[model samples]
Target: MLAPGIRVVRGPNWIWQNQDDGEGHVGTLCEIGRSGSTHSPEKTVVVNWDSGHRTNYRVGYQKQYDLIVVDNAQIGVKHPNIICDGCSKPGIAGIRFHCADCSNYDLCATCYGNDIHDLEHSFVRYQTANSVGVRVPPRQGALKIQLKGIFVGARVVRGPDWEWNNQDGGPNKTGRVMEIRGWDNESCR
Candidate 1:
């Protein structure tokens, strides 16, 4: 149903439609149609992040369609000894990536201040599944997070919140609090 190298924009939170009711659609920026946002004077959403145009929904609401950046994970905590995307030191598992021109290099929190980020990019990490969280069963009140490592080098691009975020914006805009993986409601003996 898809091809490689095709950048896609999807969300369970919102969708685009011919007639808005909060229903979104999937297509390149060239495919979306016109709505109020398509013609709004004060709105300036990026065409790459979100097509600067009109988006319909499931409800009978219509407005300038704006994209929100949120965490990637549904639930989970952070890992320690986190590696820096810049020098790739203090390497650890589960550290998040940082970037300024999100469309550019996949930099990390440590490297956010480095020359890679064109602007004064902010360094933030994600702890949600929507960003880069994983599931862990309750065993000994302990969990060891692992980075989605690659096979090229001892260092890997830390990672980033897989959100449709602005290259250089504020904190997470939206997402939900999901449950911990395999966390029993029962108390420990």
Candidate 2:
């Protein structure tokens, strides 16, 4: 699936021709339609154009693509020095989850999502490939808190707290958390 923040341009399959189409324009992907959603039965790639126009283009409708990827570096952070300990993939793509408790231990996004690391240890998330990592203080005691819930680089949804009108790509949509602020013990933003 094409991720948000990816740069894209009009593809050759874009059949629509308009003077306001802004040819040679580049846009950032903002949202993608869920495959099974009622609102968007077809795969839709929403883009925010640099020309101040926001619109969604078709991906697989009629087996054609209206947009093509120009750059995907924003989707995954590249780490030249890090190799995933779980999968042994070099230059871990996407978010790099480094074990705070283990020395020189790192896991790629896939391994981390699959729960490949020791759950007892907390991890620091690197959102960008070239991001400088910082150490997270070890949790008190040996409570063994499972690595779950909201965290930086975590995919999130509005859930039951949703009250606005499709603010986050509508129902069943998910977005990545770039940062957290003023977090409390209750985990309420």
Candidate 3:
């Protein structure tokens, strides 16, 4: 019942007789990874019953990614975080509560506690503002940075793993299009 591309381990070859209930020719087989990115991977094959032989199979190569999300301190969950949280820096690990509602920058602890941002830690902004193709809310998540705009088929960039480095965290950002609701304030739709 295996597919053409999938390879199984070739089992022992035994003579077929009306005596054995486990009828039909079978070879225990295991699959293997493919080769080049554009080429198919290699695999091992088991010869049919009554024969002891080895064969080769291949699986196509594919790209993979390791993605992870860092959590914020105060919120204790995954949210958009700024570099410094104003300036004082956050938690020792440098990972803390990040405002999900963000525009282009983040407010460090100093800025948040101070009257600089008007006591508001996070805020959102529209992509281009004026009338365009899509109808999105003027305000978005303050810490969130959406690229292509919100739609079924929008452009986006892909990245791998979570960069917890406050210094390098900025590079973790990707051009992703997200559907969000603004009336709820920090709520991500």
Candidate 4:
């Protein structure tokens, strides 16, 4: 019974197929969240992915995903300390890609380039500072998409209803957008 908030790596034999539902298969480290029983106490787990998407699955399928603790959990929060295996840099910031199959080999943005890593290899990219969950491999275009309008790390004026941590700068406050999931459909209106 993997509890919520615990990160897990997908197993080799793991199978995920949801292309028809628009949320394609997920093959990255994901946090176990949102669980409950429906009919006969059959539990389910909602996987919170780094790509700003959530997927649900039966609870007993924990064996399909192996849970592992990260060594540089503070990399993104305190400081970008994870040395880039590709470049040997001291501080690798922004989105980082880690290969779970390759002993968690990590590559910084500069080294990653246009997802030049082994195409046959599977990777998971995540933000160092926040528990933004895990994302699939070959995230080259993700950089372009992120660089679009209102990318993460951009400053914004907090509205009166801003919720998370009101102590920073409450109503009419200003703060940096920690992460960007997707476009706001109503931002134009």
Candidate 5:
């Protein structure tokens, strides 16, 4: 049932329900590590957590209690194309700043700066829909500056929603556009 790109719902581990050792933590199953030999029945399920921790559990062992594959449709995770709350533009990959208080209130980097949103409201800047590590925008505007070059060594910066790949080059790293490749996220690349 577990597969790559499939988000899993890790249920409460009964053994450690009372303890707070992060045993019942929820995360995505990243990989299925081999058990050395090809005939080996046991395998490791590598789970990458939202808290930035990677833990490996036995496949059969965890599946019985924790780790249920999440159906996006059943869980109401399916969004009908994210439109910028400020500009009303469809598929704005750069939409990063979000109002925690408001329901579904999101703003692109451009609009977040140009428009005067609630000054008292707190904002969380993220690169994608399923990114973790919420933090206030370091400053205003996009996470990275726009560049003209697309080739290697061309100084380019990441936008607010630049987490298309498993890559987060991080903020304020004035690095060149390493690659110009097609990404699955149409809004991003």
Candidate 6:
């Protein structure tokens, strides 16, 4: 589900029947209407457009989406002078992970989730953009093991353990691992 302060644009399925004037406009999600509520039975999102226009749009009403998420970052939280070391993004969004062992080293949620930094070192997870951060130590008794065969850019296919529906084309579909997250022993990607 989308949260407030996320940047969005008009979806591919946008139509003139939409409640607001969001055509060719970029906006930030201001509020989300509760599903099955008295006011809004269908899922809806209120947007504050960059052009100073504010309006509500349908999310999944009638199986059609009106808004597309451009950037999932929460812009309400500001962290001055902090830049992501992995992607070099000027402002880290969502949960900011700071390496406890490295000085002035930080990673955004995407980078942290993709294991961009040294996994041997511990990290402090910042719940918000400007939070003091909560220390997240490495798992106990877990040995540091290298990925035997899989590496970034390596093409991989769905294995037998795949449980989800065929969302990536089909069973024979292949995709590359953009980044590897967590320890190899932890069974995370």
Best by TM-score: 2
Model 5 Cα lDDT, one tens digit per residue, 1-189: 445443444444434332223443345566676657443235556655534455555556546444544322212222236677888866545335677767887776567666547655668765445656275643444443221223356664555436655354567665666653333432232
* Runs off by more than 4 Å, candidate 3: 1-75, 78-81, 88-103, 108-110, 118-189
lDDT for 100 in candidate 5 is 74
Q: How many residue pairs clash in each candidate?
A: 27, 3, 33, 4, 0, 1
Per-residue C-alpha lDDT of model 6 across residues 1-189, encoded as one tens digit per residue: 378766677775777443334354457788888866765455887876654567677898777788865444444443446799999987665567789999889987667756787877898877555446679785344443322233468687776447778877789898887875433332212
Task: Show model 1 residue runs off by greater than 4 Å.
Answer: 1-13, 17-38, 44-189
| Alpha-carbon runs more than 4 Å astray in model 2 | 18-20, 36-39, 77-189
- The 0-to-1 C-alpha lDDT of every candidate, in the order given, reads 0.31, 0.66, 0.29, 0.46, 0.51, 0.66
What lDDT is reached at residue 8 by model 3?
Answer: 25
What lDDT tens digits, residue by residue, belong to model 3 across residues 20-105? 12333223232333444232243322222112333333222122211111111212221233344456443222122234445444
Q: Which 10-residue window of candidate 2 scores lowest in summed lDDT?
A: 180-189
Query: How do the residues 87-126 of candidate 2 rate in per-residue lDDT, one tens digit apiece?
Result: 9988775567889888889987667656686766888877
Query: Model 1: per-residue lDDT, tens digit, 1-189?
Result: 111111223333343433222223222221233355554222222222222233322211245333322222112223344544456554322235544334323333334323444443433444321354322222233332222211123332212435545533445443332432213432110
For all predicted structures, in order, the TM-scores are 0.20, 0.40, 0.16, 0.31, 0.32, 0.38
Off by over 4 Å in 6: 17-24, 36-39, 75-189
For model 4, where is the 10-residue window of minimal lDDT?
19-28
> Candidate 4 at residue 132, lDDT?
58
Global lDDT of model 3: 0.29
RMSD for each of the candidates: 19.7, 16.3, 24.0, 10.9, 13.2, 16.1
What's the true lDDT of residue 34 in model 5?
64
lDDT of 5 at 12: 40
Candidate 1 global CA lDDT score: 0.31
For model 2, what is the alpha-carbon lDDT of residue 175?
92
